[model samples]
Target: MADYPRHPDREEARLDMSISQVWAAERISCPHRDILRAYLAGGLEAAAQDYVAFHLEVIRCPFCLANLEDLDAATSAEKEELRQRLGRAADRTVSSSAVFLERLRDSGAGG
Candidate 1:
């Protein structure tokens, strides 16, 4: 083999993704984070619920997986804070899980 000019940047870019990520990305049509968050909270509508299920079961998008992990890791304090922000005392129309994300977005919390 002959020595050739090497650009480490190009080489790094070519090798960036782990095999798992590449495989997952190939299959996943990842929905938006907010939508994923809503899905994680079990608040998505029927159509969105189907999409999320497909992503999780088939594509297994890593980002949504991480977001779901975060939601599962939510502390009691965090849940209480979300409930307070949504006025759980007075507003009993919706389940907290159903509204926590929307309230977080409205409060400039980036959901």
Candidate 2:
């Protein structure tokens, strides 16, 4: 019989690899974008938040993280665009009101 040298951490490494594989497999079942968005907004219930936290922190699912990041960025961009649009509208309204008031005063209708 031949003597074989055994690595002491071989079993532990195999277990770790299997655990990682399991987590990777779970990625396919990641939560939807709505849930992820709610998680980002702190709008989810405690239990749902915990699950999302585990999926993100423990499982480290890249797809969900990327989706969350994209949603957040899009949200910020939408907000900025809305703000700019409102500002432009307000400017136009103010200009129109000023013109109307000036014409009224010039036509002796300001009394």
Query: Top model by TM-score, which number?
Result: 2
Quote the positional error of residue 44 for candidate 1 in Å: 1.4
lDDT of each: 0.72, 0.87
lDDT of 2 by residue, 40-73 (tens): 8899999999999988887778888888889999
User: What lDDT score is found at residue 84 in candidate 1?
Assistant: 99
TM-score per candidate: 0.43, 0.64
Best by lDDT: 2
The sequence of per-residue lDDT tens digits that candidate 1 reaches over residues 26-98 is 6446677777668777899999899789777766677778877776667445888888977865566566655
With a 3 Å backbone cut-off (N, CA, C), the pairs that clash in candidate 1 are: none
CA shift of 108, model 1, Å: 48
| Candidate 1 residue 76 C-alpha distance from true site, Å | 5.2
